[model samples]
Target: MVSRRAFLRGLFGSFLAALAMLIGLPLSYKWRKRMSPTRHSMPETRSGAIPLPYPRIRGEMSLEEAIAYRRSIRDYLDEPITLEELAQVLWAAQGVTETRYGFRAAPSAGATYPLEVYVVVAPRGVVLPSHDFLEPGSYRYVPQSHSLLIVRQGDLQEPLYRAALEQEWVLNAPVNIVIAAVYERTTRRYGERGIRYVHMEVGHVGQNIYLQATALGLATVAVGAFVDEEVQRIIGAGPHVHPLYIMPLAKPLEPYRVSKEELIGYIESHRKERR
Candidate 1:
């Protein structure tokens, strides 16, 4: 028969082992999660550049005012959005704010910014610094450089409109900001859970753009209902980058300040169009 002291010691040892596992397993997992790669394999430094340094200045509108002014605008005036406005909106979406940590306007899980921003410009001229620079085409937003890298050269409005299920707003808008993600960038850090994180990050980025647009006196609407593959193709994104959100932006034809009756009338018209 075992001694009483030995039996109690054995039980204590077993309890310690179980407790160790409960603590050690999570600690080990956290270590791995902390060190695992979170960045995309894309080059850290690129060649082509636009250098949007003008957006360094902050906007005048308060966050509360922007939230109140934000709307899902579909009708737009026949006007081209200035390059400065584009820069501001892009900066709001994902532009690098903290150079030290490469922190952007939107937060990412584990700082693994998996989202890639792309801009599609209308055929009309976009004036920058008193002169037109960008031709009508799809351009990738290089967050690191805070500039656009031209992906393809030519008008892409028709293809984008087709891909977006013939959304007239897409066709009419001077710029369409496409948010795409490379899941592997996040998944490498959090496995399947990272996909959800990427989705959450997109929402944050989209809201930033909406608020920025409102503050700038521009109008925009986030478009998610689209043929995914078609949008990817239109934007010339690689196979790894999955398109997530499309935001069509433009100058609103109607005044931002509308009476309650006018808002109701607009809603009724929208309902009729949906039928």
Candidate 2:
């Protein structure tokens, strides 16, 4: 028979182990549930919303390669980009990265995500593998569902081109990505400082688009000189959503490739000219 004191000590140890199990199991389950990736089924096409193809996580070009090759290409071939390429580019701009927290590809101030992305596709601008083209119109990117909501039913390229100060690239490029922002989203939370934050976020998004386009062997030029009201109206955006950047994207007519040494020499030559 065990001593009474020893028996009580063993009983206390058992009680402690039981208490730990009771507390730990529920916590572990909750953590596992949180950590697991949630799957979202493709939503039914309704309300003029078209689901975009799932974006690929991996690409042929490395991040470094993409950065090195990135150029502000203005001239493009008279050809259309594929639907998949358009999807990838849009995903890079503002696609949701984390489902649990509703995080996006680019960082945002307090996760305000004030920016909205719209694509103005020219007639036969984006082609599918089957040679079918995405209907030419302005479509709003909805990140949560990874889909495009049709804003307008016909080509707004001429109006958009005119609004973008009649830039040839704007008229020629097969697709124009219009980045707009609703100030209230960020401003309401961060006060006046949020305006700066929104600008910073747009820059981040622009860089993402540039790099992604580079990776896809495409070309784009960010056009900032535009009548804000005109672009807003052309893209069918509400008054609250102000236009920020218009990036015209397409296949470059001639790829602008330059090595580091070539760039350095060019800079030096420019400096000499100034001197």
Candidate 3:
């Protein structure tokens, strides 16, 4: 007979498996390239790794300004994001800051650093200054080296967009950053409580990227609606790694504007509609 601890663990695992099957199967990619403006062809991986510039620690925009300017922007321009902009955003997300202590920009519980950052770069077929300096493919951000490790090269935006419920922004953005978490990193120390810590860490990472995007005048939105397994597959993440967030980065199509009265009116209108 199995011990009580083993029995509960098995039961919980079965519950999670059943929940995933119930939700994951129906939400599988049904819109694979079924929309307008076909995705760019797959990008070839570079044989050698490309080093990223040292992230600029100083910014013209103050932290308060960045926080105030932050917003969820979906529409993007056709221009490509330079490698420097990409590096800045990635660095803000999880780059090493305190080298001696091995700490990151975001605070990780016990410095377990469960989050893994993956960048999906697609520079081909885009009608902009060729950002061909870097290969078009999926790359994992190596925080220690401050460089990208090419996991898989090719235009992965198509599959990533599909996995993201066919969101246009996911496809249109020049780069998409996928964040995955390995719970075992945290759980070993805190047991079940470690799961909660991992999620909190992700939130910190997301806000950091959002603020950094604002400072750079770039656009990004946190995307949570996705099939976990599909996202894991798209980013070439293993089954043990859980995909937690997707942030597509690009230059905005137009300026951000809003009126106080217009906002209040919209909120009232939404209330009326709900009623």
Per-model TM against the reference: 0.76, 0.79, 0.75
The RMSD of every model to the true structure, in order and in angstroms, is 15.0, 15.3, 11.4
Output the better candidate (1/2) by TM-score.
2
Q: lDDT of all predictions, in order shown?
A: 0.78, 0.83, 0.78
lDDT of 3 by residue, 165-232 (tens): 99999999989999999898779767999999999999999999999998999999999999899989
Q: Over all chains combined, what TM-score does candidate 3 have?
A: 0.75
lDDT ranking, high to low: 2, 1, 3
Candidate closer to the true structure by TM-score (higher is better), 1 or 3: 1
Residue ranges of candidate 1 with Cα displaced over 4 Å: 1-46, 258-275
lDDT of 2 by residue, 1-275 (tens): 43566445434644664485456546543553354354212243633357888999999988977888898999899999987899999999999898755578999876767899999999889987667777777878878778886666577899999999899999999999999998887787679999999999999999999999999999998889999999999888889999999999999988767688987898999999998
List ranges where model 2 is wrong by over 4 Å. 1-44, 260-275
Quick one: best lDDT, which candidate? 2
Q: How much RMSD separates candidate 3 from the native structure?
A: 11.4
Candidate 2: C-alpha RMSD after superposition: 15.3
lDDT of 1 by residue, 1-275 (tens): 33556445434644664484456545533553354344211222234345664574566877777886788999999888888889889999999887655678898776767899999988763656646545677877867667776666568998999999998999999899999998886787679999999999999999999999999999999999899999999998879989999999899987465456776898999999999
